[model samples]
Target: MTGMEPLAPLATAGRRIETAIIGGGQAGLAEAYWLRRAGRECVVFEARKRVGDQWRERYDSLRLFTPAWADGLPGMTFPAPRSSWPTAREVADYLEGYADMIGGSLWAGVRVDSVEMLGDGSFVISTTSGQWHAQNVVVATGSDAAPKIPEVASQLDPGIRQLHSSQYRNPAQLLPGPVLVVGASQSGADLALEAAQAGHETWLSGRHPGELPVNERIAGPFFWFAQNYVLTLKTPIGQKLRPVIRHGGSPLIRTKRADLDRAGVHRTPARTTASIDGRPTLDDGTVLDVANVLWCTGYLPSYAFIHPAVIGPDGYPTETQGVAADVPGLFYLGLVFQRGFYSHLLGGVGRDAKFIAQLISERALSRNTVAA
Candidate 1:
């Protein structure tokens, strides 16, 4: 009731719709856009008060590696220095703009507490607002809702101001002392660099994937390496030939080695355990003094709220690249392998969304024909 101006939540209830897309990030928003184009009744459920909470919660200095030109929706073009990277704020703004262009039907601030399958083969989404019934549900929240912090981190001394990379913004906000940045992913590297450059004694832990020069780090080489070079590419012969490399242990993006080397960040071995002695204890028993600790470990995909049947044993949705198996009307988008080759990236959302929308359209049409 009273679904008025922006930043307002609609009082949705027991009513049913053709599609209910969860998480208003790129994937959720993209699917909603395409569904609207398909003339399907749909609504977007965003857990955050506003859209793009993920981006907003990220480090203030965070910028997309991909250019703004590659970051636009299907039709809309992001106005900017095409080749230059856009800040996290720009990304949030662009998503908001995309929503506006798609016409604001999204219900922001509505958090889906749980999605349960009803006896009649529909999804009952228990949200912060109320219940929503939908024939199809898309889990587009992506990963990173669950940040994997060390279990030992909680036992550290209270004097240590600790924060995850997700919470880190700028160095000015951190305690004015030495900072220990853990996990040298893109986020970790960027944060470490920012901290070190800010005149703080920063120690970057774990083996960092040193970034190549911008000229050498093009997307073509990256993909080729990931497919042909890395071990993730499972093939008839490649799987057998590939080494057992820990892909999960590294970041998708490279951390510029030149920047880190220039920053003089003390590189420590990969941590086994973290304990607060005089300083912080590593698995190797070496101690490092740190006034602040920034853990950039990684994120976990939390599908705990998803209905059990929809989720497989892996804690991820059981589907062939985002199509739910146990549940007919259930779908997943914006995931790692939802569709196309690049489903998780902003550049891939438009392509994946169109594919999912077409499938939904075809199914609905087929049902209508059968009924007729």
Candidate 2:
């Protein structure tokens, strides 16, 4: 479909398409842009009511860790000062604008239920609205979809207000009293600081992932260059650091330990491992009596919609770079450390998208030639 064409109606049966990109976020949109440039027809399926709802749904005070200059996707620059950090709303607005500029077929408010590969290698994508039959399917749904909360959360007092970081909007949602923010990554630190600044006694649980070696503003260009070009799977250090980054989580980008301390946020080195008498218990045997608990524990990869044949034990697709080797035309995008540390970031996803798009275009051409 052309950029000028209206969004195709949802067919309850199955609408055939050349390529179905299973997301409308930065990753999916980038793939669509590259495919369009390659003269390939494609459609983007976005579960949200609108493009960029993912970012908009984050905490109200959320802003990109990277400066605006490093947050734009392919074909468009983020409309903000280069050195400025764009807020969540601004990123969302930019995505919406980028989608409009791309003008590819995008189905909003459509949730894909499942993706099954046929005997012939084509895909059957079942969705809330309808089904789509496509020769190629790019799973660009991103890494952070499902919020990860520990099973011990159920033991917390029912009176205690609990919320995962994803569900938290602002301090207003928190109950009046001391708040315990679990997990000391960027989100945890940010929320803990916010809670403390909001006049609540806040305790930040779990050891931090560490902070940047230098202030990002002072080393913006160098940091960008390292993350984008130097720190890659191709390098020995990048390979060694991959597991630490993937499992331990990225280092604090915006939130620093000093910042948390400055906000009067109590920092705990122990993790919130259990609950005692309806209260949070730390691994160090300290029990925290708080009115609210904010779980900033991060997210798990959710690819349950994908078929078992395509998904691995890690809940991720078995793919190299972005191309699925087992399933010829199946691809994945925006995976953490997919190609490098920046693979899932806005500025970095375009490279993986471009690579996958080229492969898909080449395969399409080969298929057409064979048929002819």
Candidate 3:
């Protein structure tokens, strides 16, 4: 808050900063707030041209399927009743405001190349723009830092006009014909339903019916119970569970059987894998004649900038909460559970950010220094 610059061109080259936040997303912005409140100095490096660019890049029709009550950032709420979940653009605007509140030290569009520990044990974070030195690092780019489109997705017929969920804007932007939506996850089902409702012949392919919501009265405090007691998501055993994680059931906007029927959204059998006679083919050997394909497959977390020595067999930064055994001083927050499952939620990031920020301050800047 004291000494801040808007756009820094490699701060006095080679001058070391105490810490560097490696993202400008929800996690990065949250951490920056805490880092400042704690009287710790740091710089935030964001690869995008502006804050909330990630959300801005999402589909135009996307909304926070999680209720509006869950959309609060550290010190601010969505400002309506708790039920006002924000659209993608609204969230992005909130983040932009957050950046302004934090004094705009976000160096946008500067991508990090590699982060290596020097002989002196400090971190040397090199980027496309320049370099920065920090005693501590927070990798808060979030889970969907990169999209996980399959290699074969590109090999589909050129006439198909394929688009991933990330690139999809609206049905109007799609081809002038029926559309085939692949994957049955929330994105897939929602897109299929939207397409069909927009007067496009839409077919959805998914094996799992996915999870459905419960009546609030009967379910009790399901969210609270799940976060505090259950092992469905971030708990120890659940983390080791399996390749197929339990779905969030249905999103708030339900894509139920009735909804599908009324919307004329057809559900083709699962296992659909290819394009036939220039159309998408279902696993049952049936073909859905269409000119557009929407692949809402999902995203993969990428840690390629991190060297393999610090990575595990799964090719991720092997860390616990914000602590990593192999890589000391390498803390990750706003990840799966620096606090809880809601840690990733807009409202829940403050707790995670505070916790991680406290740890960082203690380890890197505390007057009563405890060895990190």
- Best lDDT goes to which candidate? 2
TM-score of candidate 1 on Cα atoms, chains taken together: 0.87
Per-residue lDDT tens digits for candidate 3, residues 338-360, read 44556666767777788788888
lDDT of 1 by residue, 1-372 (tens): 122233323354777777889989999888877777777778898878877667887788887766666678776788677776778888888888877777646888888999888887778899888888887888888866778888878777788899988778888778989998888766778888899999999888877554444542385346434432342223443344322121233333545677677988777766737675636777777787778999888777788887755565545567775678877888888765443335677766777788888888987898789889
Score candidate 1 by lDDT: 0.73
Comparing 2 and 3 by TM-score, which wins? 2
**Residue-level lDDT tens digits of model 2 in 1-372:** 344343454445477898999999999999989888887888889999999999989999988778888888877899999989889999899999999998858888989999999998899999887788999999999878889999989999999999999999999999999999999987888899999999999999987787777776855566578778777899998888876676656778777888888999989899899999999999999999999999998889888787744666666677788887677888898888888988988888899899998899899989999999
Stretches off by above 4 angstroms in model 3 are: 1-13, 214-253, 275-278, 313-315, 336-339, 365-372
Candidate 1 has its poorest 10 consecutive residues by lDDT at 241-250
**TM-score of every model?**
0.87, 0.94, 0.86
**Top-TM-score candidate index:** 2
* Order of candidate numbers by TM-score, starting with the best: 2, 1, 3
Winner by lDDT between candidate 3 and candidate 2: 2
Candidate 1, residue 30: Cα displacement in angstroms equals 0.5
lDDT of 3 at 114: 82
* Model 2 vs. true fold: TM: 0.94
Q: List candidate 1 stretches off by more than 4 Å.
A: 1-12, 213-254, 276-278, 309-314, 337-341
